[model samples]
Target: MASIVDEDNKKLYIFDEFFRKGMLNNELAQMIKDKGYSKEVIIADSAERKSIDEIKKLGVPRIKPAKKGHGSIMTGIQKVNQYEIIVHPNCTNIQDELDNYSYKKDKVTGEYLNSPIDSYNHGLDALRMSIQSVKRKARILTVKL
Candidate 1:
């Protein structure tokens, strides 16, 4: 859906979306590889195990899995809100999702739900997952060092 290159331009954060729907995992890998991001670290949804496996088969570098949970989602949302996440101008889907995505609400109580409506969330999910993974890895590296 969107990608953010770090200030150094060495790292790339790819937010998955349906820019072209029905694309196979291998095809997607090739497309990313062709774009010269093959060596960059890729943070992908851990829930999509099959697709992740397929991408792994292509030998993409540093394919990190992003764990999804309520806490992680909340944290990711907070991170996005707290920082300036600039998206590429060409990433229309990312812009659209950011604009239109909303939390589900209960009809009777008129209360906002904890989770987001699923329909327009692919890009958002990808972004959240990537943010979570980055945070998680940073913590790990800090602990290790």
Candidate 2:
């Protein structure tokens, strides 16, 4: 789980759980709603096209696709730093991902590469998507007015 404070400093917490055994869209949507995040936005992986469609069928609101690429991930990380981030203690996967996440290194020059290591990144990816989704929404709102 992750929490973010908006421009008004209002805090909102969003949760996502991945079941290795796989969960039905209805089941997952109910679980999320039970957690009191039914009104909050959900950022899902675009790779899960079928799952996204199924979740939509379940009537869950504000489901958005996460922007892919290192730049989007980096932007999310920056946004996290900009806001106060509160992680639930039970969110060990997120903590472990943040702890072990690193940038690739050049073999000959020993310089850090732009790409990030793919391992231990599931939680990180979810968090990144959430942040990016908020940022995108904010941008759209700004453009509208």
Candidate 3:
């Protein structure tokens, strides 16, 4: 899973369900810890989907329930306000912007390379916010409502 938080203090956090067990969990936790972040400051937002053991293994601070028993568009947006940085997928519209960046294509067939099938809109939004945070320039495609 992932970690989400609320407020500038970064005291509140939301973590995903897969914080423990497999190598993935360890890696996820290690990534944050490696950056010198405490598990207490990180919360698990999707704990219901995963086992409690997995949640504890991550050692994050708080666990919040997912909205409407599942992740919804509104909840996803709400998550943005909770944390300083949000790393998610970019929506379909974002593809147009990313399209400008050349990706590897089939050299032999001369076919255009395909973008990731997964949604990167959220990640793009997060990245955009990060750029703005650093006083970098970026195109604003969507409203922050």
Best by lDDT: 1
Estimate, for each residue in 49-128, the C-alpha lDDT of model 3 and write its tens digit.
46323534676333222333343433444544344543234333344434443435687997765432334343333322
The sequence of per-residue lDDT tens digits that candidate 1 reaches over residues 19-129 is 666777788888767765566667777777677667768966556677667678777777656545565566677778778989889999999988778766676766666
Best by TM-score: 1
Query: Which sections of candidate 1 miss by over 4 Å?
Result: 5-18, 136-145
**Full candidate order by lDDT, most accurate first:** 1, 2, 3
Writing each residue's lDDT as its tens digit, candidate 2 over 33-110 gives 676665666667767767766766777566556666747767766765566555566766666776798889999999
Residue 122, candidate 3: Cα error in Å is 5.3
Model 3 score (lDDT):
0.36
Residue 60, model 3: lDDT of 35
lDDT of each: 0.61, 0.59, 0.36
Q: Which 10 consecutive residues of model 2 have the lowest summed lDDT?
A: 136-145
Give candidate 3's error at residue 119 in angstroms.
1.9
Candidate 2, residue 41: CA error in Å?
1.6
Which segments of candidate 2 are over 4 A away from where they belong? 8-21, 68-70, 135-145
